[model samples]
Target: MLHLRAVCPAERTEAALDVLRRHAGATHLVLLRGAAVEPPGDLVEADVAREATDEILAALCELGIDRDGGVTLEVIDTSLSDHADRAEEAAPGDGSDAIVWEELISRTGEESKPSWTFQAFLTIACLLAAVGIATDSPVTIVGAMVVGPEFGPLAAIAVGLVARRWDLVKRAAVALGIGFPVAMAVTAVFALAGAFTGLFDRAAVFGDQHQVDFIYDLSAYSLIVAMLAGAAGVLSLTSAKSAALVGVFISVTTVPAAGYAALASVLGEWDRAGKSLLQLLINLIGIVAAAALVLLIRRRGATDGVTTRPLSSG
Candidate 1:
């Protein structure tokens, strides 16, 4: 279930009410007239089935509540009202399977933005991965993966493709395009510094690193793993079960490959660096392809039982 709070202008209140009343998935509706101080409008709140979110939000958007006022949707973690249960039953699809398009787009769009925090996490993840590669430690590699933030923009790219949001696509692309190179370059510098201090050995990185050897090994299995992880990552975001994302994070070798590429380049092992770069590219491409596919399937399912007329008209 989801909780919707909307501030609607007086003129559009009736229209918003009518739309909410017409939807069987909406319940516990409350209207506080002239309660919005900033917008100087009425505050409307309701509990809605997750599956009906897209449609109800579309209707609100059609009424210009989103443009003239504001609408906020929040997950109802524990709704004790029977009306909420009835609303869920009245809705068409399972809540977990439903794709809230507005919510998904808003979330991915925000996450995809190039921020200092995003760059910091990516750089730190790469640095950790550099340490992992130098030590040939799977544990350190997994830790680096967990700390990596690359998946946000990657997932956003897939969402943008499906939703036809070119702005989002561009933002995600810029984030990734700039982020990875910057992170790799920083890691390369760190590697050079480590080498100067005798803390990193080029021969160790190029030979007998079985535990972390897979970072440079691009194979069919690598593609398959990336595809699965991508699918799972999208599902985790859309389904609001974000705990699953941690598993997805560690399942792919994106950060580790970048780390290896940077380190190999620093060590002047051009061949190994190229192979690691190839591995990174394969994982990235595989993830985006698979995530797009998953989102398309979910989008189709969301549209099956719901009409997009409101969004279309708007």
Candidate 2:
């Protein structure tokens, strides 16, 4: 899954090889005794490995090669292998030492790279929600939830915090903050137009409503739902075995809440509209806070020192 080639001192070759064999997830091991030579990538390719990079890197730190000594660690993605005879070694302690903060940050960056398609998806979700609100159709409201793409940035923000990438955090925050308001504004315009046309004021709409039909109900369940969604979102980003993020995205009601709020505001139900807006705000704050907290915990395990690359002026 990962290809690693390292050049180290003749004396430390065995030790480095031991670490590689023990924690690098190398099916086959190779070590060349020479001066510092860069790996295939000019920079250290730490994230290429499918497994155990974090553990191997920690072993390197423990072996004194990371700090005092001069050994270059290079990793890449390839199926190639070079076998080297080595003495038997013990396995790392359940491979807990690897943190790979750089790799995590890089992944977050990759995830945060936005596309026009996502914007289109958000627009569609908002419009679908407006239609649902206008027609009093809960099924269409759920459709809107399924269509929204807010989870990408939500998960991206969580990963950024775990990786200590403030730039990513800022970008994700901006995307969410701006996007939600934009969606609400667009839906609000539609709601106002629909209200003037008597679409929302149709007979027998509010007369037959049940107690549970309050779209603006900002009860404990509202906060609980947001909390659960936030937790699942972060977990989906971190774990390799799970790809349940899309489901989480569909289950979250943020866009629906906003659309409903806009519709209610247009219908002169300011009380319900304000409650729905508060619910939306609560969801956003809860998700962001939870994501940041999770990331902070993950960052504690990171061995890579903080990188201070200059921001691009363009």
lDDT of 2 by residue, 1-314 (tens): 33444444445567766665555344455443443543221112222243355556556556655444543334442333332111111322222223344455555555555556666677778888878766778888788988887876776677666556677777767777777777778887887787677766734344465432545677777767777778767656655424676667665668877887776776777776788888778887777677667656655655445443322322
Model 1 lowest lDDT segment of ten: 305-314
lDDT of each: 0.89, 0.60
- TM-score of each predicted structure versus truth: 0.95, 0.68
Regions more than 4 Å wrong, model 1: 304-314
Checking candidate 1 for backbone clashes, the offending pairs are: none
TM-score of 2: 0.68
RMSD of model 2, in Å?
A: 6.5
| lDDT by residue (tens digit), candidate 1, 38-99 | 88899999999999998898878878898789999988779898888888999998988999
Which ranges in model 2 have alpha carbons more than 4 Å from their true place?
Answer: 1-24, 27-51, 54-100, 110-115, 202-214, 297-314
On TM-score, the candidate that comes out on top is 1
